[model samples]
Every structure is written in C-alpha cells, then in structure tokens.
Target chain A: MSSVRLLVGTRKGGFVLTSDGKRQDWKVEGPFFAGWEIYHMKGSPVDPDRIWASQSSGWSGQVLQRSDDGGKTWNVAGNKFLYEGEAGTHQWYDGTPHPWEFKRVWHLEPSLSCADTVYAGVEDAAMFKTTDGGTTWNELPGLRKHGTGKDWQPGAGGMCLHSIVIDPTDEQRMFIAISAAGAFRTDDGGGTWKPINKGLHSKYIPNPTAEVGHCVHHIAMHPSKPKTLFMQKHWDVMRTDDAGENWSKVSGNLPTDFGFVIDVHAHEPETIFVVPIKSDSEHFPMEGQLKVFRSKTGGNEWEPLSRGLPQKDCYVNVLRDAMSVDRMDECGIYFGTTGGQVYASPDGGENWQAIVRDLPAVLSVEVQTLP
Target chain B: MVRVELPAHLCRLAGVGHEVTVAVDASPVTIAAVLEVLEHDYPALEGTIREHETKQRRAWLRFFVCEEDWSHIGMDAVLPPAIVSGKQPLLVIGAIAGG
Candidate 1:
C-alpha cells in the first residue's frame, strides 16, 4: 500500500500527518517538543522510516534528534556545530568584515542512498555532514573556505545555508545555496566548492550580476534531470540548465516575482511551483489575494492555482523552506504559511484543503511518499 | 543525596518528575556533581541546560539553592549543607527572557 507522511515544522513545534495514499482522511500526530522552534524536519528518501529534526530553543540552544522508527521515538544526536579552524569572517552589512558565528541549524537533508548519512545546513552559513546517523557532525569546510567567502554578506535573514540539492546521478557532486551569498557547487563530495551565480542579477547589490551576494530564497531540482535547477530568488524566479553554471530569468508571467519557497513536481522535471509575494519589502500576497503560480512549461508562462486557496484579504508569507511535493503517481503539493495554515493539494495544485488551520506559524514543510 | 528541580520544559524533556533526587557520589557535593549525574541519567539534556564543550551554564538558565542565586558561583564550589543533604532541592530554572 502506498501512503504519505507530511512533516510540518513550525515556530512552536513539529507535527506529523499521515494518510493511506488516498490523500483523504489524515491522522494528525503531534506538537512534538512543544514550544520549541522546529526549524526543519525531513525523512530519508532511501529509508522512509528514518527521520531527522532540528529542534532549538532560546533557553536550551540547538539539538538534533534522529528517529529511526518514523518518529515513534527520537534520540537526541550531536548539537555541537563547531566551525573548523578560525571560522573566518564575511562582509558585514556595513561592508566591513565580521567574524562568522554559529546559529541554529536551518535545515536537515538526509542522504538519498543511505539512511544514516545526512547533511545539516546552519546559519551564519556553513555546511556539515554526519555519516553515523547524526551522532556527530563534521564540518565540510571547503564551502566556506572558497576564496570569495569573505565577500559574502548576510541578508535580513542572517546568512543561512538554507537550500541543499544532492546530485542523484553523480555521488560526488552536490549543490548548496546561501542567502546573500548566492549558490555554490561541489564536484568532489563537499571537499571543495565554487560559487555558481554567474547569470544572476541583483539590483540591490553593488554589481547586478556579481558571482555571489545574491539573496537566493530557495532552489529545487528534479531527480530525473539533476542538471536543470529552478530557483526562487529574493526577486526573480530563475532556472539553471548547466547545473547552476549559468542562470536565466524565469519569472515569466508571475504577478510578483519577489517571494520565498520554490519546488519542482515530483515526476515533472520542467513543471515547477512558486508562491509569489507582493515584493521583498511587503512580504504578503499581491492585491490581498493568495495564488500559487504554476509553470508547466518550466517558466515564462504561469497560471494561478487558487481553486481552494484564499483569494481575498489573505496576507501570509511562505518562508523559504515551507514548500514541498510528494512522489505518488498522482503527485501532491503541500505548503505552510506564516499565518499558521498548512494547505495540501492531493492532485497537483488543482484544488487545496487545509490539513490544519491553526498550528503555530510554520517554518518548514516536508512530505515523504511512502510505499 | 542532592535533591534537584528542573524547569518545566526540561522536566518534560528529561521525563522526570518535578523533583529528582540523585546520589551525589561524594560528600560536600557541588553543583557540578549534581549536573554530571543529571546528564548521565538523562542524556537528552546533554547540551540543553549547559554547554557540551565549555560546560558553561546556558545564558538563559539559572541555578539556585536555599533561595540564593548560585548561578554566579563556580560549578565546583561546594553546596550548602541543606542542599547537600536533600533538605533543599537545588533549582535549575530557565531564566525568564521577557522584557
């Protein structure tokens, strides 16, 4: 039997919603680690029973927990994320170098081939990996040691390495994205990395198309076509054909291109999704209406999916990590909002329903297609 | 024996009752000894109340014994007789962050 599990991480806790593939009739399971900020929760693509969550509190600091039996129980793993070497410096808002600092883990990405291996993306922007099921994390320093790292600056979100894409065809290659620092790719399994924001243009920065310093909100890649990537930047919706070596504007027909969170359909390599906000400064839906623009032709042509979404007086921003898609034959799309709602569309984005309307403001949403 | 009380969230996380009593393993027990036992018994609390590397108390946490703030004192300093004997439960509180 096929099934679906939705892992919803909110500002206050984490929840698990399960359904028997029908995508109807769900059983909502938690508020796990109540009152704590569950920055991200994800299950391993290779092993659905294995899940990882990044739980943090201002009072308790950061803690990583691993669940082997699909969230039935959790073991607190390594929370220590010590920067290797001197933990160098990056440019500050004032254009002066400021030392790098370790903040909470912003996202956890499990290995596609093994359940025990996972990656942790942390703020103050750095990358880490754990091969022993999150028991310990070792810094993959090459990403930060890139020559131009000192020139990287933080966006208002604080310099976070929020997006990670594993190249399925090549075991040794991987890609990571950082806000205000653009994107970086590693050909040697994270040992080394290079900035890949060649065609990106950010008017706010000193150079519109500098190699780095673009506030990329999120990036997505289809498993089938790992070379082609889609990105939702702070301003433009973009696409990369040569695995991020170059990018081109794909904002196309989006009403407003300034938004966070972008994802590709599980089965369609060219079909993508993006929730357009009014602008970077406004952070809300345009004209008080919420619409999810879907581009079936990759980009440049989009149609609004508002059948079941709020069409009037709705004002909630979707954070960078709050959108995801499941892999069932029919395909499913799910997203959470800052206004405490988790919306789901079992059949693509044709129609929607709120899985839970009043959760604490959601920070991230991930769904696993279970077989 | 040293009786101890953890903050609400910590208690729930540690899966212990409001008060926990642990064998100090030595006389004139210090706060450090109590924490060592607490962490050993509840491994989930490894870096929650105090740091794993520096062993420094989390900035948002407080320690108290006999109604006196012991957070400023060294972790190795001996506790008062009342606390060491279980007459007073050393309190580990999450310092309020409200303005």
Candidate 2:
C-alpha cells in the first residue's frame, strides 16, 4: 500500500500532512518556521525524503530552506541572488521604469531525476538553479537577457515568474509563465528562449493581442501529454495544442472564467480543475457559492464539484499556487483557500473533505505519493 | 559566553527559548564576531540577521545593547564593556512596521 504526504505552505508557517493509502485520517505535523510566510514547499518526485521551501517576510526578506529527512529537520540554503551581468529595469504598474529588484521567490521546481538539482522562480521575474542541492544558486540569466526584459511590466501582483513546467519526456525543454508578461519557452534548456503567448489576449493591457503582456495566473500540463497545456488567464480558460505556439479560449460554458489556479488529473490527462472567482475586483466565489469546476473534455465545458464543499454563503477564494493532485491508484485532489481550509477529495473531486479546517491562510499546496 | 536576546520569531527559528547564550571565541569580541558565531552555531539562521554575501545588517533589523541602537555602528567596532562582560545582553530587534 502506498502512502501520501501533503506539503502545505501557508502565510504563517509550513505543515506536513500524512496519511495511509486510505487517506481518510491524517496526522498534521507543523507550523515549522512559525511567523514567516511560507510561500511554497515541494518534495522531490524522485527522492521522497528531500524537500525545499521558500520562506519570506516583510521585515526579514527572503530565505531558502531544505529538508533531507522529510520534514523532520530543515537547513537554510544560500540566499545570495545576484544578476549575472548588467541588471536592468522593467516597466512599473504605471508604465514607468522600475529597477528590477528581488522581492521574493514564488515557486521552486526540483529536477525530476536528481533531488539535489532545483529551479527557483522569483519575483521581479527571473529563474535560478541550484545544482548542489540548495546550498548555492546561480541565475540562468539567458531567461531575462534573451530580450523583452525592459518591455515586461508588472501586474497588480508584481512581476513574478510563478510557474515553471519541465517536459516529462525531454529534459532540455521547459516552459515558464510570468504574470503580465505572458508565457515563454526554452527548448534549449534555459540557454535560449522565446515568448509563446500567440493566442492569449488580455483586456487589461494596451494591446490585447500583443506578443507579450498577459496576466497568466497558472499553466498546467499532464505529464503524459507534454505538448498540450491548459492555462488560467486573467479572464479566460485556455488550451494550447502545439506546446504554447498558439492558444485558444476554452472558457466554454464556465459561469465566469476569472480564476487563479488550473490543474490536470493524475490518471485522466484530459480532465482538469479550476475554481472560478467572481472577478478580478471581487476575489470571492461566484454568488457566494464555493465550487470546483471540472472539465472532462479539457476545456469549453465545465461542471461544478460541490458535494462536500460549502455552496451557501461561502465566500472564500483559492490562490494560484494553492491547488494540487496526488498520484495514486485512485486519483486524489487537494486545494487550500484564503479562508485557511485545506479540502481533500480522495476520490477525484466526487466527495470532498477538509483535511485541516483551520491554519493560517494557505499560500501553496503540493502532494507526494510514497511507494 | 555572551548572553544575547533574540526576537520571538528568531527564537522559534533557532529552537531556543526567549534568550540564548552565544559562544564568542575571538579575543576583544566585536559585534561582527558575535554574529559570525551565532550563524555558525545555528545553521537555521545563516543569513537571518545579516546578509551572507555582503555581510551588511538587514535594513529593517537593528542591533542594540543596553537600550542604545548599535545597528548603524560599524560591525568591526568593539561592543560596550557591559555587553562584552555579559552584564548586558546584546539584543537583535526587528523594527516595528506601520502602526
């Protein structure tokens, strides 16, 4: 029987949730680095014992932490992040030049093969890699220096590289998404890159169909199908067939497509999940009803999953990095909300339950299946 | 051993109680030497108080001894006699933000 561990990062701390194959009863483990905002925490798919965390605070700034014995003990990795060459500036929210600064790390993507290797996506928009575990980090400057560094502008949330997708079949190819900057691809393994936001359109930017400048919230791809991707943009649910070369709106019959997270099923690659908020201005669920919509056909059609969820007077919102899935015999889904509840669906979105109803507001959630 | 007091958050991060005793190994102990010892003894707080690359004090954090702000003072500068003799504990304070 396989077990599951949920690596949850919240506004105030980090928690480790463990359960047996049944996943009915769970044991909650911490607020490990209490009082700090745990932006993200992820376990290596190859080495289940290794974990990485991004911890930050308004007063203390940024820190990277790693754990070797699962979450039993953690060590602070190096936090010295410097640009490779001449650092430049990006456009501010009001279209004025703003010097590129390291605000905080948003995501950490460990390599599929080696637990010691990982990629960090940071705000002010840049990518960094750590080859010798998390002891040291080196920026892959080609990402920002490739071009478009100046024209890139910050979204209301600040310019951040929040998503990094590594092709399961090919290690040399990768995709990354930046808010207010659209999607980008690096087929040559971070040495060179190009924008892949051809079909994306945003009403917030001056040019709705420009080559860049789309507030992409999240992008997910089922490992089995590396080329196909699903995107939750500022106002639309989109799909790309040719690996982001082009995209098409699949908002379909969704009540309102303004969402922050999008995820694909573990077993069924075509099935996807999204939680549609009221709009950009109002970050609550639609009509004060909390629902998780599933699309079996990959887009254009969506069905609400609210059996074990609050549907009346429920006014919570799920952030971009707060939703995830587990790899098991029967697929399991999990998501956390700004309201501090972590809901789990052990049976693939049919019946849901709150794993931990109270914690600090969750910032991110990730799952690991143990053999 | 030099007596030191950390803020609540740093105390929890170092897995210690409100105040901690640091082993200052250098002769004529200085603030920089004290911080180096703290970082070396507590791996979890490698760069929490000062920058690892530049070794500069974090902007929002201040160093104090006996109610005097020592944050702007040079790191290599020797501490007051009371702090060096352990009569007064060195305090690492996180400046209060927006009231």
* 10 residues in a row with least lDDT, candidate 2 chain A: A78-87
Name the TM-score of candidate 1: 0.96
Measured by TM-score, the strongest candidate is 1
Q: Which lDDT tens digits does candidate 2 get at residues B1-99?
A: 788898888777778888778889787788899988888888767667887667888788898978988888889888878888889899988899746
Q: Each candidate: what lDDT?
A: 0.91, 0.89
Q: For each candidate, report its DockQ versus the true two-chain complex.
A: 0.71, 0.54
Could you give the CAPRI-style class of model 2? medium
Q: What is the per-candidate TM-score for chain B?
A: 0.94, 0.93
Per-residue accuracy of model 1 over A1-371 as CA lDDT, tens digit each? 79999999998889998998878788898898888899999999888888999998889989887888998887788888888898889999999999998878999988889888999999889999999888889999999889889999999989999999999999678889999999899999899998999899999999999998999999999989989999999999999999998899999878889999999999888899999999878999998888899999999999999989988899999999999999999889999999999999999899998888999999999998888
TM-score of each: 0.96, 0.95
Candidate 2 local lDDT, A216-297, one digit each (tens): 9999999999999999998999999899998999999999999999999999989999999999999999888889999999
